[model samples]
Every structure is written in C-alpha cells, then in structure tokens.
Target: MSDAWQHWAGFMADLAAVLLSLTAAALIPILSVRALRYLTARRNDHQRETLHRIASEAAALAEAAFADGNGPRKLSLAIGYAQEQCAGTGITASADTIRAAIEKAVMDYNAMVKPWSGLPAPGAIAKPKGESYSQ
Candidate 1:
C-alpha cells in the first residue's frame, strides 16, 4: 500500500511540474501581446470616442442654436467651436478662414430650411461649409 501511494505521489508531482512549465511557457508571450493589444486598442478607442462625442455635441449645439432662432450670433459661436475642433483633428483651416466657412455653412443651412417647418428637404444634408453660397 505504501509503495502504491509513493507511485501515485510521484506521478502527481511530475504532472504538476509539467503543467507549471507549460503554463509558464504559454503565459509569457500571451500576456505580453494581450497587454500590448489592450493598450493600443484603448488609446485608439479613446481618441475615436472623444472625436465622436465632440462631433455629436457640436451638431447638437448647432441644431439647438438654429432651432432657438438665436440668429447669427449663436450660430457663429457654434461654428467657431466646430472650427476649433476640426483644427484639433488636423484640419488645416485657420480661424479666419473657418469663420468665412461658417458663414457659408450658415447660408447652406438657411437654404432649403423653413424656420417654421418640421421636415428636412430632400437631400438636404447640412454641409460643413459651402463656397457656392458666397460666390
């Protein structure tokens, strides 16, 4: 009985050692790659999420400004904020140009829009800016 118990113990110890070595071998690179992927994905996701939230907020602000009929002043402020965000996102327009661009945006927004109406016109997407409005 004692001999049988010793054999079982030896077998168990060998299995445990093998398992530990296998786990160690598998764990090192797997943990490293998982950590690297998690960090990279987190950074990219954070940047993308921030940009998406900013765009949503800007759109809401512009829509509210338009809805409240706050006139050119509120819209101008909204456009200015949008322009700053665009520049932050690597767009190349300066604030002065962006201001003019905002005016064009406002014109486009004003066109095909009825301040009192509830429906959007066909194919009437709000442009970031419009050159044709000034020309």
Candidate 2:
C-alpha cells in the first residue's frame, strides 16, 4: 500500500507539471498579442491628437491672415506657416491637404451667417482683435 501511494503521487505531480506547461504555452501568445494591440492603439491615438493640433494651428493662422487682409494669399500663407509649425514640432502631414481644408473652412464660414445675430459677414475672421470668441 505504501509503494502504491508513492507511485500515484509521482503521477499526479507529472500531470500537474504538464498542465502548467500547456497553460503557459496557450497564454503567452494571447497576452503578447493583446499587449501589441494596446501599444498600437496608443500610438494611433497620439498621432491623431498631433494631427488635430496641427489642423487647429493651420486654421487659426489662416483666419488671422484673412483678418489682416491678406486677400487671396491667406490660405497659402497659412499652409506654409502650418507646415513650418508642424516641422518645428516634428509632426508629419501634407501641406497641400492642410491648405485645401483651411480654404474650405474659410469659405464656408464666409458664406454662412446666422439670421438673428445682426452681425456682418465676418469671413474667416471668427474673432477680431478684441473679440472674446477665441479667448
């Protein structure tokens, strides 16, 4: 009876070892993939936020140029300034696309006006020097 019990205990120990090995083999790849996905998502979010900041800077510069009466050169100057700003901050984006988007935003703002506001067509100048809109 003592010898039989010893053999059973050894077998149970071997089984436990095999089960632990299998669990590790199955779990390692799953955990690695999940970690990779989390890192990729974080990188994407950072890139997105950087792009948003660049776009905002571009739009604001274009609006300021317009308000300064830059005429047809407002969008182009804004794009150039935005590209330089992005380069300064190490952000990557297309200058032409940024220019086009700023142009559209300026035009849209110029074309639309609320009826009850009693304000003139402000064009791209959403906030003038003393205007509190931007502040």
Best by TM-score: 2
Model 1 per-residue lDDT at 49: 56
List, residue by residue over 1-135, the lDDT tens digit for candidate 2: 999999999999999999999999999999999999999899867865665666666666767657767666766777777677768877666766666656665554556644435556667446657766555
Tens digit of lDDT per residue, candidate 1, span 13-126?
999999999999999999999999999889767755554454445545777767766667665666667767876786554556555555555555556474546667756966
Taking all chains together, each candidate's TM-score versus the true structure is: 0.37, 0.56
Q: Which stretches of candidate 1 lie over 4 Å from their true place?
A: 58-135
In model 1, how large is the Cα lDDT of residue 72? 70
Error of 1 at 80 (Å): 7.6
Q: Model-by-model lDDT, in order?
A: 0.68, 0.72
Model 2 bad stretches (over 4 Å): 69-72, 88-90, 95-135
